[model samples]
Every structure is written in structure tokens, then in C-alpha cells.
Target: MPAPPPHSAGIPASRRAQIGAGLSDSLGVGLGIFPLGIALGVLVVQAGLPWWVSPALAIGVFAGSVELLLVGMLAAATPLVTIAVTVLAVNFRHVFYALSFPITRVRPGLPRAYSVYAMVDEAYATYALMPAEKLSSARMVTGQLAMQLYWVGGGLLGVWVAGALPAPIEGFEFALVALFIVMTLDALRSKREVPSALLAGLAAAVALIAFPQQALLAALIMFTAGLALRYAVTRGAAHA
Candidate 1:
């Protein structure tokens, strides 16, 4: 068979289409991410950090909530050991996310590496609900790249806005909480995983009460154990 013709831009037509579709898929998520990125930038400036720190975090960390937390920690001059532990505790969930992410669809080499590196929560959620047949390396990578662009662009814009403002804004830090709440609500609506949600809440409450100093780490551990036990029982019942 003859090879497919190239797009006017010199890329293969099919490749171009895949890239376009990926960008289109990212549009909705980008809308949400952009504002949060802006918030991060504003927070950085308000915290008295250099304007460049916003894009640096966006690129280096790429974890929204963690970046926000880091801003506060950096401003407070948090100890290195504590910061390291907190970052690990906060991002440990990504280890689980990797287990189910469709990384096999991507080609090996730099493409696969980039796909793995860019597998943020938004990308994971987007792919989890996507039909398996529709997945492709180009689409996944392009979508991730587009989301990052939104974040970087928003950060720059926000820096400009913050510089123009007369005074620092209060309550901008709440954007992190607001984003998570929206994500949680959306997940509930889509999967109706009420039991899992309830378990998470219980774990958080217990951890807060019992291990206040280590609440985040303790809650994550408890939640993971609860999920494992639930799965084992459910599987055994099915077999029985």
C-alpha cells in the first residue's frame, strides 16, 4: 500500500488529526488548570517569591496541590527534611495511579518517558474514562503537552496581573482546596463510588484525631489498607 500523504504542515495527515484531537480533548481540562496556574502565580508573588518561581514550579513539580503547599513552605522557610517527607507523602498516590495508567499505548524511548513523566491526575482521570479502543500515543502525549502549556501560559499571565495589582490578594490559597473539591465532586458524579468516598472521609477523620502531626501521611496509609481489605473481601465473596 502507498504511504499516506503528509499534512500541509508536513506532518502525516493521520498524525496531525491525532494531535488535533488530543488538543481538543485537553480544552476542558485546560480551562480548569489555567485558572489554578494563575492562582499559583499570584500566590508566589503574594508570598514574596520571585516571579520566575511560578513557571519553575509549574515545570519542575507539575503537581498543582503540592506546588501550592511548597509555596507556603518555602515562604515559611520549612526545613529540607520536612519538605522532602511532605512531598513524598503528598505524591505517593501517583504510584498507584501509574499501576492503571495506559502507558503501553505509547511508543518506547522519549515518548514513553515523557508520557510517564506527564501522567498527572488530570491525565489519569481523562484516560481512565476514555474508551480503550480510542487510545493512542500521539493523542495522550499531545493532550498532556497541551495541559502543561495552559499551566505555563496562565502562570505568566498571572505574574503580569500580580505585578499590576496594588496589593496582594487574600484567600487565593483557597484555590487548592476548591480545585480538589471540584475534582472529588466530579468523581462522585461519574463513578458514584460512595463507599470509597466514605472510606476516605473516615480515614481522614481518624488520622486527624489520632495522628495530628502526621495526618496526611497517616490518612493515606489507612485509606490504602482499607481499600486493600475491601478488595480482598469482595474478591473472595465472588469466588465463593
Candidate 2:
């Protein structure tokens, strides 16, 4: 049998427009995510997981960080309930992302579903940077589709590359730590966030001193509660 054609000349004109828009919009983000996806694919294989898990998580879960952590948990035979809770806690921020996301701008049905499914951080950032007039269903959906393609394809390629490795690779776990550090530094750059950063540092210190074995989760809970309480007190004092 012959291989398929290189181009989408056989596709309809309207569909082609969607494809073109998606490809163009995805260019900047695709460059960044493609390598990360490949790294994730490598991580999965290094974690002793089957290669297909990478694409499965990318296509199904669509969360790079959670998926990377999950591959390790799964390899360790973590319980389903524990995994579910961790996923919820880690991705709870997406609920807030959905509030301001341009999901409504896309046409309803499959395109809309695709928009929601592909609503990653990069997609949200892309939408934010795009001109209001350029926002359209085809552009939005196709952009997401292109990104998924890069991720899924890179994951498959990573698995193949991992299979060729002579021995187990080291240093993959540092990716998660590095990402969190970058994000923390980014969050701390704003003047208004300085107080919150200080509070977080205090919370981390307390959690570490108190719950050494569960410092991360304890610190997150303590920090969130402290922030909430502080907000409530400030509001009450202003009203009084």
C-alpha cells in the first residue's frame, strides 16, 4: 500500500482554513511544548511505563505536569482514590482559568469540545495575546488540534528514543522541581504578590517544621487557608 499524501489538498476549503489558522497560531507555543512533550514521553518510559501511556495522558488528561507526576505514581502502584484526589488538588486552578477563557467565542459542538479539552496554559496564553478581532472557532479549535498533534507525536517519538537508550537515564525528576521554582519566581515578581510570597514562605516553614513527611500538601492547605482568612478579615475591617 502507498503512503498518504503530504498535504491536505483533499480536504475541503473551509476545513483547510481551520487547519491553516490552527497551524499558524500554534507555531510559537508548539516550539516550546513539543520538546516538553518529548521529554514527558522519555520520562514515562524511564519510569518503567508503557510508551502508550504518554499519548493516552496527553490526549485524555491533557495536563503535562499532572501526567508526569502520575506516571511515577502509577509506576509506584498508588491507589486510585489517592490519584483522584491528587489530580483534583493539582489541577483545581483550571477551574479559575475556565472563568476567563474564550470558550464561548468558539462555535458550539465539536469545536467547542475541542476548545475545552485543549485548554492548557499555553492555549490560554495564546488566546490572551491574540487580537480580539482574530478570535474565531476555526482558529481556536485548529490551534488546539495542532498543539495536541505536537504533544502526541512527540510522546510517541520519545518512547521510541527511550527504547534505544543503553541504560536508565537520570535527572528527569528535576524537571518538575525546576518548573515549580520558575513558576514561584514568576508569581513573586509582582509587587502586590510580595506579601503573599512571604506568607507562603512562612507557611512552608511551619509545614516543614510540623509535618515534615507531608510538608508540600500541608503547606498548600495552610497557605490557602491563611490567605482566605486574611482576605475575610481585610474585607470585614474595611466594612466596619
Candidate 3:
């Protein structure tokens, strides 16, 4: 008899469909991540660290924007306490993302944990686009896994490209800023989000001018609090 079939082939048609959708949805996500990953890899080398650091951050931290900031800090030889605080401030938004994202499809234990760990902005945006009826636990997890692979793979490729270059290229470090700009524009497609985005931008500008020493942390705190208060007031007004 032939050897046992591979696992993917044995999955149900519906499950297969779900997996395919997940992979397909990740294409646009990969477009954004790949360049950013390349920038990160180049930045890693520019910072005078080993090539391994880029992929290591992509795999270990799995955060794009924050990892960019970390690269700068590592280069400056910044203190660990400041780095810790900055990381917490930047990543604190994930707490809110977790609040609304549906993870019921993920089975318990490590699988479920990985699903949560993989909940980057791209995954969140894709999940929000799908109707409840169209989503399956298998599909959701598969799509997230695919996106993570794209990001990790992109970082590794960037590392390779950086190594191949004759000398470190200047200005590639700005890719992180460009990536965030693109993400913000994509997110602002909804009219309802425009106000919040503007508010956050205002907060960032203020922090940049008034609190340059701790700009990112200050901007994030202001944005978070301002948005929370706006939502609460809106809800209260609606009920009244």
C-alpha cells in the first residue's frame, strides 16, 4: 500500500477552502511586510550588528514597528530600562486588539497561544474584513500562520540581500516610517476611524515638539487615553 497521505490532503473541503482563503488574503499583507523586512535586515547590518539579529527579531519578537525602534535603540546603546518602557508603550495597543479579535476558532493550548502571538495588524485587518459565516478556526489560524511566515521569510531574505551588498546603503532605515505611513492610510479607509487617526497624529506632533526626550511614549499614552475618553463619551451620549 502507498504511504499515508500528507495531512493537508486529508482535510475536509470546507477546511481546505478556508486555508486557501487565508493564504490568499495574506498576499497584500506580504507586500507590505517584505519591504519592511528588507529595511530591517539592512538596518541591522547598518547598526553594525550581525546579520542574524534581523531574522532573530522578526522570529523572536514578531513585531515590525517596534522592532524598527529597537534597532535604533540597539545602535545608540540605549539603556535597557528606557528600551523596556518604550516597548511596553508601543505594544500596549495589542491589548485592545486582543479585546475585539475572535480567537474562538483556535483550539486551546499552544495552538491557541500561537494564534494570539501571531495577531499582527495584517491579521487583524483580514479578520475584520471577513463575515462570521465565512470564517473557520482552521482558516483563521492558517491565514495568520501564512502571514507570519511571509514576515519571517522576508526578514531572512533581507538579511541575505544586505550581506550581498558591497557596502551598507544609506537611508534604508526610513523604511519603517514608510511602512507605518502606508498602514495608517490603509486603516483610514473607514470614515469612522478618521477622527481617531487625526487625534493620534495630533498627539504625536505635540509629543514631538513638547516632549522630544520621550516622544513616542508620550504620544502613545496621549493617543490611548484620548481615544478611550472619546469612546466613553460617545457611548454615554448615545445612551442618553
Name the best candidate (by TM-score): 2
- Model 2 clash pairs are none
Error of 2 at 127 (Å): 1.7
For lDDT, the strongest prediction is 1
Given candidate 1, what's the lDDT at residue 24?
A: 91
The alpha-carbon lDDT assigned to residue 70 of candidate 2 equals: 82
For candidate 1, give the lDDT.
Answer: 0.85
> Candidate 2 lDDT, tens digit per residue, 148-222?
888888888888888899986888767767877887899888977887888889998999999886666677788
Tens-digit per-residue lDDT, 1-240, candidate 3: 999656675787677887898788888888888777877787888888887888788888886688888998888887787688878877877888888788776677876798899888888888965778877777788888888787777777888888899987888777777767887998899899899899999999999999998777678788888999999999999999
Across 1-240, the per-residue lDDT of candidate 1 in tens digits comes to 999665586888778888888899899999889988888888889889999999999999887678888888889777676677778877888899888999988889998898888888889988867887888889999999899889988998888889999987888777778867886897788564777888899999999999887676678778888989989998999999
> Among all windows of ten consecutive residues in candidate 1, which has the lowest summed lDDT?
4-13
Candidates in descending TM-score order: 2, 1, 3
TM-scores vs. true structure, each candidate: 0.76, 0.83, 0.75
How far residue 237's Cα lies from its native spot in candidate 3, in Å, is: 9.4
